[model samples]
Target: MTNYHDPIKHLNFLRQTLSLDKKPIGFFVSAGCPLSVEMPKGEWPLIPDVAGLTQYATQELGSKDEEPYNDYDRLLKEVVKSEKDPKNIEDILSFIRSLKVVAVGNDVRGFNIDALSEIEKNICEKIVEKLDVDLPSENSPYHKLAHWISIDRSVPVEIFTTNYDLLMEQAFEDISIPYFDGFIGSRQSFFDLRAVEDDLMPDHWTRLWKIHGSINWFQKENKDVFRTTRTDEINSSHLIYPSHLKYDQSRKMPYLALIDKLSKFIRKPNSLMIMTGYSFNDEHLNDTILNALKSNPNTMVIAMLFGDLTYKDDNGDVIENYPNAVKLARNRSNLAIWGKDEAIIGTVRGHWHTMDDDFDDSINLANSITFVQKEGEDGEETDEKIYSLNLGDFSKLGEFLQALIGYNQTNFDEN
Candidate 1:
């Protein structure tokens, strides 16, 4: 019946991975990163998440009356009515792309390829417009991450992100950090598959792989994918939204290659992957990670969720947070799910339990995890058996990293 997970023990394991300079450390940052950024004076996120972007795209597309808009409107209505699961603009785009690779082709909604192309372009441009905003300041979380990467290490740091925004790149450049994103040549940076495959770059140079296509990426008439600093110059039709639909060409693009890189990175011995701001929403990626875990027993994946592992429902039922992820972690010894108030490590799913004497190294360790009160059936407050973990949010995670580097530790106890 004793089912509490020790945060101190789990974090010590994490510290070992981070402390060892020779170990290969990687980060999988997803949509929550941008959303976690604080906007000045209660402004919205620098860029909207998928749901927010979907809402924005819906409003923008619905406002227009042109041929493309009409086609998009019809397609949206039909797609939503029939499928009922196209959650965001990316999912919608993935659906459209799936249609392309199918036998039906552009004949699904009585629309041709040209109309589909137009619809994709409209959504992509809107997304780019929304994501083009610059970082808030040098003290941002991303900049902190950049600082973390800048630390002395024998093995190169690999950062894999599914976002199309340039925030990560901006963070690296802001600190004069040398990094490569699988692009080579001058102004029009063409993707060098060999460079990505070989990874001959120095250890100091970070490898930034954007698994999802970026705003700077575009396709030429020759079907060559190239990147540029100018987002406005690129066409959205070329962006890769890899879904279940498989094709020979897509397997060769940066999507497959970057995904393969993830698999390869995890397969390496002693490799540790820290996932932040990522839910198990991406089933394809979920499969990739789980399969990798099965293949490599020596590696570890620590997923940091933005919420607690369990919540009280209206029926007073304890609902697990991101159940699929938790389930996967329970089955895989190498995979750890780190939530706000609890964690699942080595097939043990439970809340954090720690004592005051657990703080040996830094006082900030006490700041990250704490104990909250509980109530009894008589409506009186009772003692709780566990602690509340708060390292899921990117802001707190960044402060933890800063505290590790001796930059700042005061924020760990603050907001």
Candidate 2:
């Protein structure tokens, strides 16, 4: 039996869903969103991707014989000795925090309490410095997303992101779009789990939940966490949740509550969650999303991937696959992986096809799906043809959204 994905039908369904949806619609933005920001010369990103950030951190924290920070290299080696991904900053930071929590007054992993704390400090500082970037201008992708949300709709869009950067915040402010992020107050906005649980805010005001915490978040001496805009007011470590990667600390406040919101959002009847820029590397989030799918059949999770979801081996067997998402999609009909070269929908994996032979958007589907002259290994154009749907890229998704709303698409690049 041959199964194929009809791109036109799927796109029409998506457009219809967006047009007449009265229920909840969410956009799960992740780390890859920031990789779209290019420098002035357009050489590299203003903020590096996770892989690039990890490499940068490793180099920045490397041992310098001239300096006294040799302990960072030693600590990193010990923490990541058996880790499959040795350069993962989140895992490294998690291990450091776990060690610090148990290292009380003694040496753990050959490092004393003081040494471990210093290493943790160095890593956190580097992460904050690298992620603290301003959006190039109001015309950028983030602002496009904000404009999409700013448009009047029956249900205000809910944006749930795992990124710590302030790009989203900047965009929202630039457009004067009001949003709530689990905090309440006119002064120092303090985290109010009760408000988040009660869900009293108006639907017009968008909901922006940073499940992994943000760089501007700070904890005071009184154990109260607040959001601050002034760097001088940042007194301590940024309240990030990579520490919750620990089993013992998984139920900590704020992190646990924010994650719960995601589960709640998906459980709503007739809901849609469009995921972009996520690598699906975090097992905890993956488990949460999968569990929510089981609990609610009405909710749909559209996981758009930046690459192929699966590929065939030399023998023509589909041996390679996105293990987590593919395995989950095999059983769940509500879950869909709209990948670059392929897609997994309704428990079937295959390339994209269109029922319409005279496809009007064959140049691409909705300014997102691109029809390419398939290139060979040498990068030369081949006789073969292929289709690539890249709504997974934040920029493309933004463009798609603008076109969907019939907004200012012509002047999108002017700024």
Candidate 3:
């Protein structure tokens, strides 16, 4: 029987085999869930001024008074109708746009936080409350991983996130982990001067690529700057709100060049991409990932599926083919799927204080080791566990990163 229960042993074995120090791994975070806290309305908290306007609108619409706009279905319609003049309509629409509700995709339509309506804000507030109850801060995982990787790897790790929030930056600052984002160095420069200069490669500093514009990212005076703290003195033009492709256009040449850089980085050989909490909904983003896989077939993708792996077919029947969904099937061999149940099992005790204690981390570790061994045995019955764990338990985040680093090191050294 293959003894897969010992995580330390498994990690050490993999590290010895892969020589992980030679090649670096890349992390791509999907803003929806894995690294992001899901807000009910899909809305991120903007600067205080914008937030105040939103609160005012919500309160004026009877949200604070708990009065229905007009029953339930007609609430939004009534509000729109209340603005008889075109200017009033424009003002309302502008306020609605300022709320930055478009950030939430179509998937959350039925939820109370659907779009950027008052209902959505209320829902998001509740979620935030729940989150506050469990974790002291959102930067917990980011800081932990950043610190761990910095100490373990020779090369600074690269983090690419599609989120528009400052959570990641906040985490880095809280931990005092220095990071170099594509933004922040220059405002008016059309090209990434940092990319051209060797100074960009500062020693022991992580590269944080915000693929999408951040909440604090704004263009002004023909330049872009990302600010984390609030500032009322800044001009209205300097406020970076959640926007669509237009935001990308606003960056002009710099944004395009950054995307190209990211594309090249992802295509590197022996590179492992760890994706968490992304739904693979954005076609353009998906294309980038697909292209990366094509460029390097040997690349490994470890995806954490928060829920079941099943998807419905066109006929509305649930299908067993999970990780095999059309968009993901192309690189099936390198794909690893972890669900919620499995996450609890795979997590390390005391590493994450938020997860339920009832779940067996040891059993999950044993199972994962067994699954890897079984895959290597060509279907032969080995004393290894073949079951995979779920990806729900947040604590598993640390363990996953650790295992991945170990696995990469082992594979690198063996080759």
lDDT, candidate 1, at 67: 55
Poorly placed runs, candidate 3 (over 4 Å): 1-19, 34-139, 184-193, 196-199, 223-230, 237-250, 311-316, 319-326, 330-337, 340-386, 391-394, 402-414
- What's the lDDT for all of these models? 0.79, 0.79, 0.47
Candidate order (TM-score): 1, 2, 3
lDDT by residue (1-415, candidate 3, tens digit) is: 2212333343343335234675666666654343333233545322222224334434544333434433223334444565522223223433344333444554332323334555434423332232222223544555546655655566667777765556566667776788777644333323354562333766577778766544454455545444433444334332322223333344534445456656766676767666675656555666766677667767666555555556588999976533333336434445444443232112221111112223354334422322232444476756543343433333355545444443443334436
> What's the lDDT for candidate 3?
0.47
**Selected candidate, larger TM-score, 1 vs 3:** 1
What tens digits encode model 2's per-residue C-alpha lDDT throughout 45-106?
87888778878888888875655657777776776585636578888888887787788888
User: What lDDT score is found at residue 255 in candidate 3?
Assistant: 48
| Model 1 per-residue lDDT tens digits across residues 1-415 | 8677777776655554576767889999888999878888767688888888888888887746555556667878767876745557777887776666543443656777777777878888788778878988888889888998888777999999988889999999999999999889777788888889888788899999999878788876677788877656664454645364564463357888888999999999989999998988888899999999899999999999988878899999999779889878879999998887778888887767866534665644526666666778997778654576677888777767766676322222211
- Stretches of candidate 1 exceeding 4 Å from the true structure: 63-69, 102-106, 231-244, 247-252, 357-363, 377-386, 407-415
The number of the candidate with the highest TM-score is 1
